[model samples]
Target: MAGGITDTGEPYSPYVGLVYMFNLIVGTGALTMPRAFATAGWVVSLALICFLACMSYMTTTFVIEAMAAANAHIRWKRRESERVINDSDSMSDYSDDEVIIRDRVDRSETRPILSVQPGVSPDHFDIVERVEMGQMASIFFNKVGVNMFYICIIVYLYGDLAIYAAAVPISLMEVACGNHSCSAGSSIKYNDTDSCWGPVKRKDAYRVFLTIFTLLLGPFTFFNAQKTKYLQIMTSLMRWIAFTMMIILALIRIGKGHGEGKPPVAELSGVPNLFGVCVYSFMCQHSLPSLVTPISDKKRMNGLVLADYVLILGFYSLLSFTAIFCFDNSLLKDMYTLNFTDNCDVIGVAFLRYFLGLFPVFTISTNFPIIAVTLRNNWKTLFYREGGTYPWVVDRVVFPLITLVPPIIVAFCTHDLEVLVGITGAYAGTGIQYIIPACLVYLSRKRLQPVFGEDMPNKHRSPFHHTFWVIFILAWAGSCLMFVTANIILTETKH
Candidate 1:
């Protein structure tokens, strides 16, 4: 043992691994997943969640095991470098000793002394068997172009909270209080040809304001680059708190009656949209860290599989079931969270607002590192300066500029939050999270065989085996394209 509790080669504590994965997998994604289920039909969506959970568990564990192997290789290399430096120093010290002895000894004795054998060969000291785990990993990932494509796919899949949808719950809250000032419903008349209802092609000012808030929040993510350690700790803490709040909310909805009878069709539709948001938002990249832990200890990775499923399904089921009673599917809006008003005491509302705001902030912060990495790769070549002197220019100027685009389009185009989330989730969600990862896993596995000389056992084979991913990839892509078409069909031209 290295010390009191250090195994020197052990994985992180099982509890910590579970906690981290729960946060990563169920984080922002949960917020909207409930509504998505309601939209897709609760029965079908529930089945899919179970299926995805299984896939995620198996895939995540495999990736972590692979990462641990690579970590072992890196440690081996570092130790070898240190030994080389130490051996050279020892040779210099021995040469000096020989010189001192030669000056003091008779010339005739030198021949006899030279015949004495050295006690040990320095080259043999601390010899470690070479393991090409790192090279194996690189070959595995690069062969299928996964290392490059994975991040892009993740980014594309993470289509989350459109600032435009922020208006939905706000409008719902206004209606609950018997106020019609910002009601999007009253402002529009449906036209069969245009296929949507809105203020005779008018702008939704309130939605625009919400969109502005979403935009303002985007750049704030960059602030995280300044303090990663603190952010991680805080993120861990906040995630738990968020999870707890969700559970409590679910419980309350379960125990209490969801209020009077059947909800409207629109509200029901919002359910699926909300569910989509939660599912997509729950996705996180923390699974990537297992790539650094030792193999012998990699079993700890399974803890996440257990934690994410239990908590995620628990949270999602409760939220969806309660939503069935309390909300009319027809009245569904984007920020259904805002609709949780009747369930709130002062403290609950405060927590709700805080959580709602905190997630966007955190999501933006988490996303910044990725966007930063991407920008650096694409733009750094253009700068051609040592240490990337103009980095601040990109961070300070270019990022904020880029951040504005999505919010602006959303502000003008979107009137209902539920509709917006559904559109984004159906298209972006399918592509980024499910489809892309499946492709990377398949391609990366092919690369691993040639390099590692073996296949990673799939105790948990993807439901359809390798071919299933191909089917899934195409399915998700088709869904995304279809949703985009729906958006075009439903949209009304602004004159």
Candidate 2:
């Protein structure tokens, strides 16, 4: 969730919320989009990206609606507790803490009151309280659904960590080992067997870099990791500068009529990769509560979210389109920033070239530990027992080790960013972004209807409030999973 907020408890304007959403959605996923676009063909990429953006926006609304429902439920519970206290004068003799404890024990033994009298209404869309996605799941979902939700999120976070773990090393390897003197007209591909230095192959160099990367950043998982405000400012500044430089440079080369790309009109084989990348790129649904909760003015929240989606769609289209046109598809790197390195024709300044190459190294390094710790915490939550505490060794040593080792091992085995991103986004990413939200919002509405009565109004209801929309989203997610799975199967068979 961009880590935790570093600002004072001040609410931001809607426009500021839009910017935050844009930044959140356009992280490492955007860096991998150009390669996906080049593979899938520009025309197919454009259409698919647009469709996915619409789907992502729809689910974003679902989350907001669910959040409002959660707030309404909390308000209802508090009101019920007040009524109970008022109805019994004898209860006044109990301490507040005693009454709260008694109420909690009673609540655990009782079925949730889902029925409110008709003609009663409450303001449900007030964003004063924050309800996280996990809490919402515990409130609205059945046991099976709650477990599924956590599993999906845990998987997505692991995918995030793996991508980050592989990316920085790949960037370092490219810059440290590859020649940076090549002209833009030249298309050179480095083989794994190619020597990086004395007796070191390029592939070996990548592993070494990965090892060093793990050594440098791995320990942060054992401790709480945070990005300070100054670090965030510097990261954002570098991000914008790097992105603008790439876009402008690509446009310049195109204007000079020196563009080398000849992308296809459509390519079915590349569609799966593009699907995964797009799903991964448009992932803000899970973190929407944190992003949407602190906005000062949420009167036009739907409009603001719509505007943000449009802006992000346009930004992604511009970035990828320029990239696919500027470079040949086969020559595009998994990390888009690497395209500027070693290409003097596109970027004349040597310093800027290296900066672009090393940008991910700086930005993603900040994010990796934060994500690792997040994943570790989620693991603890998943297996955590009620009222039972973990031993210090299990809590400290086991959780961090489990969180850190698997992704590192995966990164070590293969540094193929495309495959990693494709698998992660296609499966777990789809479940988290599409399927879970659909189920959560649908179940929330069903559970909330009895509590609020049919006449009670929810200000944050999704635009696509029909049952058909929920079914459509789940079916789409299921179909995408099946398609990606079958593609992997067929590809393996062919190999």
Candidate 2 accuracy as TM-score: 0.92
In candidate 1, what are the lDDT values of residues 1-495, reduced to their tens digit?
000112233445556555656555654345455456556666666666676555444445444433334333344456668877875666576677775675467454625211213453222111122222223334345544433443343333223334323443244223323212232321122221231124321133344444555555555534433436577687777666655665565456546753422433343333345435644554443234432232323333455455656776676666555555545554433444434433342124444645543444454445444443333332333233445455687756675455444444554454454455555555555544455455445654564344333533333233344555456556755764665565456554431
Error of 2 at 1 (Å): 8.0
Model 1 has a clash total of 36
> TM-score of every model?
0.58, 0.92
Estimate candidate 1's alpha-carbon lDDT, on a 0 to 1 scale.
0.45
Q: Which stretches of candidate 1 lie over 4 Å from their true place?
A: 1-11, 65-258, 261-279, 285-287, 290-296, 342-396, 415-420, 423-428, 455-495
Candidate of highest TM-score: 2
Deviating ranges (above 4 Å) for candidate 2:
1-8, 90-121, 182-187
Q: Kindly give the stretch of ten consecutive residues in candidate 2 with the minimal lDDT sum.
A: 1-10
